[model samples]
Target: MRIALLSYSTKPRGGVVHTLALAEALAAAGQDVTVWTLGRGGDAGFFRPVDPAVRLRIVPFPDGPAGESVGERILRSIATLREHFDGTGYDIVHAQDCISANAVDSCVRTVHHIDHFTTPELAACHERALTTPYAHVCVSATVADELAAGWGLKAEVIPNGVAYERFADTDPAARDRWRRRLGRYVLTVGGIEPRKGSLDLLEAYALLRERLPGLQLVIAGGETLFDYRDYRTRWETRAAELRVRPLVLGEVPDDDLPALVAAAGAFAFPSVREGFGLAAMEALAAGVPLTVRDLPVLREVFGPAARYAATPEALAAELAAALTGDDPTRRTAGRTLAARHTWAEAARRHLAFYRCLG
Candidate 1:
């Protein structure tokens, strides 16, 4: 089968990561796979090297005019991708995000999670993406249920696959390097965005710091097309009020990410909304203690592998336990859980779905 997987950006966001991994896995299964994405900010390729078997079509999307609203950017993104993408020969045209789903004439969309957009263009685009697709997929049953309840659309639930070995097999020397540089730290990925519950994490870290004075808060990996300046400004003001200074590493090298995850004393995932907590799963694979927001999707995905918390106070308590307690059974369960989600299995299931569409 000739499959074309479409994504909105070349950055290392979770959806883009899923697109690349699934494409590679499909190619490995002897299917012809081509990935289509817009090269935002003049990017020529993906954040990491892709497997040679999978073909790439990177459409150049130069920066928009200064002072462009996010809604304007969304419209331009769809037009630009629509202008460049030719899904002529693919047996399965799968779109991974709103932009690509809106850009294409018809496709099978993977609704990683549902979002409520206020921007008129963005809201319209989001609605069209959800309503227009011939078939839909979700990374968790919780999200699939959302599609069913809100839109009355039934979607196939296929969980994401973590690069289990990449993290689990990280060298001890590499882990030690991060520890030497940062000391004992609690880490979270996905930047200081509202959805990530960045402000909540800040509050929790402040509370935790009172007891664990030596522990640090580290944040990494925030790449997105939307403007979060207003939310970020609010976060900064709140951080100042809380008197906590988190080491904000915007984006780390992909090669060093596993070691960084492995070195953390505790991994924090306080996201208010998520399709799947890929980064948290990576932490599990790295044998790091995990704590996440008390969301149904996360509960379904992490099960006994992670600690759950609902508020800043609860998050702080969970993080403290994750750092101080030695629950070897839970740790073992985490590693086994992460190892069970393989890209090969995800790919096989995706192929079966595509066949059913025929």
Candidate 2:
């Protein structure tokens, strides 16, 4: 089968990660696959190297000047991708996000998460991306239910696949490198975005420090199409008010991320909303203690392998427990769960879905 996988950016965002992984999986299954993406900031390739079997098409996408509105950027992103995307002659065109969905006339779209846009143009684009897709796939059953309840659209639920062995068998020397540099730390992937609950994590970390003063807070991975400077400023202000100092590592090298995950004292995921807790799952794969928000999606994805909290206070308590009271049985179960989700299985399911559509 000939397939084209579409994503908005070449950055290390979750959706982009999914796009590359899925494409490689498909190629490994002996299917011809090509990935299409906008190379923002002159990025000629993905943050990490991809499988040679899967072809890549990186279209140059320059950033808009300073002070560009989020709405304008969204529109420009859609236009830029639309102008460069050539879906013709492909057996399937699978769009991984709203921008890619909006770029094409007909394609299968995977709604990783639903976003509420205030701008009229962006709101319309979001609506169209939700309603116009020929078919839809969601990463979790909770998100699938959201689409069903909100739009009366039924979607296939395909949970994300984790690189189990990569994380589970991290080199001790590499993990030691990160541990040595950061000391004992609570790590959170994804940046200081509102949806990520960055401020909430900081608030919780402040409370956690009352008992665990030796633990530091380390944040990594944040690449997005939208602007979040104002929200980040508020997060910074809150961090200051709470007298918490967090080390924000903008983007960790992909090669070093697994070791980084393995070295953490605990992984914190306080997302207000999520389609699937992929980072949390990776942490589990690494046998790292995890504390995530008590959201339905997270609960569905993480299950008993993780600790859950609904508020900042609760989160602090959970982190404290996870950090100090690590259970060998729970960690074993987490590794087992992570091992069950394989990219090959995901690719088989995707191929079946694509064949059904064809």
Candidate 3:
């Protein structure tokens, strides 16, 4: 089966990671896979190389002032993509975001979030683009439910998977480095975005500081996706005002993430909205016990393996307990659960989906 996977901009973000991994997996399963993405800015080395088995096609889309409205840019890119895919034959064309408007015989669109419903123009564009018959894959039931209720679109739930071997390997140097700075630290991985609940984590850390003097918080990942610099600055100032120490490691490389997770005492994710929390799963796979907020998708993925904390105070209390408590049983359970969600299984599911389209 020849499959064309479409994503306008395939950067090294979570969505791109999912698209690339699935493409590689499908190729490994004896299916011909091609990735279609927009050309990278001046630096071609920005994106990691795709697998040798998978072909890559870059369609040049117009670039203008970064200050231009996103809606206008999206419409322009969609028009360009439609022109590019005019005669390209594919068994299945899988579009990643709501903006991709490429027409194909059998199309599968993955909805990570519903941006269109929030804005009138985007909602109209989304409705127009998605009116064509296409199978929809939602990363979480929450997203699917929201789409069904708001947009009246039906979607299937297919959770994201991680490469187990990547996190399973432990780097002694990383552990030693973290141990040197060590106090009991709660680790949070993601961009400092409102939806990610970074400010909430800061608040929770502030509450934890009074009780635990030696407690530290390490936040990994860079700036917010939507250019919320003011929000991030406010959090930084708030952390200082509360006298809480935060180690902000911005935009870590992929190879370094597993090591960071392995060195942490516990993983903390207080995100309010997420299609799927791959960072939490990676931490779990690395044998770090998780303490996440009560979200449906996370609850379904982590099950009884994780400690649930509702409020900031509750989160702090839970973090303190998890860090101080020695629970090999909990760690074992988390690892066992993480083992079930591997990229190979995700690959097989995608292959089967593609075969069905054929």
Candidate 4:
């Protein structure tokens, strides 16, 4: 089968990662797959190197006019991608996010998560992306349920596949490097965005420090198309008020991420919204104890393999518990769960779904 997968940017966002991985897996399954994305900031390739089997078409997307609003940028992104993309001759055109879905005339969209945007242009874009797609996919059943409830759309649920072995078998020396550099710390990814519940995590980190004064909070990865400067400023102000210092390591190298996950004392995921907790799952693969927001999607995905919390106080308590002891059973369960989700299996299922659509 001939397939074309589209994503908005070449940055290391969840959807872009999914697009590249899925494309490679499809190619490995003896299918013709090509990935299409905008090379934002003159990026000629992905954050990490992609497999050679899958072809790439990275359209050069320059930065927009100075002082453009987020809503205006979204519209421009859609327009730019639409102008460069050619959906002809492909049996399937798959869009991985709202921008890509809006770019193509028709596509099979993977709705990673549903966002409630307040901006007029953003709200309309979100609506059109959900309503206009020919078919829909979601990474978790909870998100699919949300789609059904909000738009009366039935979607196929395809859970994300983790790089199980890569994380599970991290080099001890590399892990030692991270530990030597950062000491014992709680880690979170995805930056200081509102949806990531950054403020809540800051409060939780402050509370955790009362019990373990030496423990650090290390944050990594903050690449995104949307601007969150205001939210970040608020987070910084609150951190100052609480008298806590956090190490914000923006965008760790992809090659070093597994070892960083393995070295962490505990991983904290306080996102208010998520389709699937991929980073948390990676932590699980690395045998790192995890504490995440008590959301239905997380509960469904992690089950008994992780600790859950709803508030900052509860989150601090859970992190304390996670750091205090070693739960071999939970670690084993987490590794087993992570191992069960493989890219090969995901590719097989995707092929079946594509065939059914035909």
Candidate 5:
């Protein structure tokens, strides 16, 4: 099968990581895979290298001002992509986002989020794009249900998989280095966005500090993707008022994340919305016990394997317990669950989906 994976703006983000992993897996499984991505503006490092078996086709476009509408840019990108795919004869064109223009072939669309449906104009855009005759794939059952309820669109749920070997490879020396410098800290891995509930995590950390002194909170990710600087500032002020120290390690590289997760006493994810919690999965794969919000997506992904907390206080309590407890049962359970969700299984499922297109 010849598959074309499309992403209008593929940066070094979770979406891009999913695309790369899927493309590589398909190629390794004896399928011809081609990735269509936008060219990095000026920095070569912005783009990740694809597997040798997978072909890459980059379409260059104007990196315009922030004020330029994303819909207009995506339309232009789709036009460019159509020209590129004119003769390639791809068996299936897998579009990552709802607004992706390359839904030209026997397409499969993945709904990463439903934010566009909130606005009138954007909702119209989504309705138009989603009306395309494509087999839709949702990252979680929660997302699938939302799409079916909101837009009368049914989708298959295909949860993302983590590279177990990469995460399970724990180096005691590297873990010791991080533990020595950072001490026993609760780690949260995600951009400081409102939907991520980072501020909520900060508030929980503040409350936790009142009871358990010297408990450090380490946040690992880049700055907020959206304009939530005021929210971030407010959290910082609240942390300061509560005299809670937070180690804001912004945008750590992918290679260093496993060690970061392994060294942490416990992993925290208080996100209110997520198509799928990739970071939480990574932490679980790294043998780090997780304390996540009692959200549908988290519940679906972790099941009874993870400890759930409803409020910030509950989350803090769970975190504290996981950190101080000597029992390794939860860690063992998380590893076992994560090992079951391998990229090879994901690849086989994806291949089956692609075959359905024909």
Candidate 6:
């Protein structure tokens, strides 16, 4: 099959990561797969090196004019990709996010997680992205259910595959390097955004600090298109008032990320809304103790492989346990579960889905 996978950016955002991995897996399965993405801010390549077997088409997207509204940027981004993307000759043109989904009609879409939008243009775009596609895919049953309930869309559930060996097989020497640098830290990826539950994590970290004075809060991998200055300002102010400092490593080197995850004393995933807890799953693959927010989606994804907390206070308590407690059984369970998900399997399922669409 000649397949084209579209994503909004060349960054390491979740959907982009999904697009690249799925394409490579498909290519390995003897499918002709090409990954397409908008190169925001003059980027020429992806955050990490992609498999050489999968073809890459990076569309150059220059920054919008000064004071350009997000709505305008959204419109421009869709127009730019649509104008350049030649989806012809592809058996399956799968869009991985709203921008790419809205860029073309008569395409299949992967609805990672549907969002609620307030801006008129954004709401309209979201609507089209949701309803325009002929068929849909989701990363989790929880997200598929939301599509069915909200829009009567029957999206096929294809769970995300982790880089199991990359994370699980992290070299002890590499892990020791990060441990030497950060010194017993609790880590979270995905930036300081509302959906990430950043404020909640901040509050929880503050409470945890009273007991674990030596433990640090380290954050990495924050690449997004949205403007979160207000939320970030608020987070910083609170962090100052609480007298807790978090090391915000904006984007860790791709080679170093697995080791960074492996070195952490515990991983905190306090996201309020998630299609699937891919980051937490990576932590599990690394055998790191985990504490996640008590969200239905996360519960469905992680099952009993992780600890959950509903409130900041509860989160603080759970995080403390993760730092100080010993649970070899849970560690073994997490690694086993992570091992069960493989991109090759996911690619075969995707092939079946595309064949079914015929």
Per-model TM values vs. the true structure: 0.99, 0.98, 0.88, 0.99, 0.88, 0.99
Pick by lDDT: 1 or 2, better one: 1
What is the lDDT, from 0 to 100, of the residue 71 in candidate 5? 52
* Candidate 6 ranges beyond 4 A from true positions: none
Q: Candidate 2, which ten residues in sequence have the lowest lDDT sum?
A: 221-230
lDDT, candidate 4, 1-358, per-residue tens: 9999999988878888788888999999999999999988788999999999999999998878899899999998899889989888999999999999999999999999999999999999999999999899899999999999999999988889988999999999999999999999999988889999999999999999999999999999999888899899999999999999999999999999999999999999999999998889999999999999999999999999999999999999999999998899998999899999888888888888888998
Best by lDDT: 1
Question: Which scores better on TM-score, 1 or 2?
Answer: 1
Model 3 agreement with the true structure over 202-300: per-residue lDDT tens digits: 888888878777777888875322456788888888888877868887777767777778888889999887777888888888998799998886787
lDDT scores in order: 0.95, 0.92, 0.75, 0.93, 0.76, 0.92
Off by over 4 Å in 2: none
Candidate number that wins on lDDT, 2 or 3: 2
Ten-residue region with minimum lDDT total, candidate 3 = 38-47
Worst 10 residues of 4 by lDDT: 11-20
True-structure lDDT of candidate 2: 0.92
Cα RMSD of all models vs. native, in order, equals 0.6, 0.9, 2.8, 0.7, 2.8, 0.7
lDDT (Cα) of model 1 = 0.95
- Candidate 2, residues 274-298, lDDT tens digits: the string is 9998898999999999999999998
Model 2 RMSD, rounded to 1 decimal: 0.9
Off by over 4 Å in 1: none
lDDT of 1 by residue, 205-230 (tens): 99999989989999999998889999
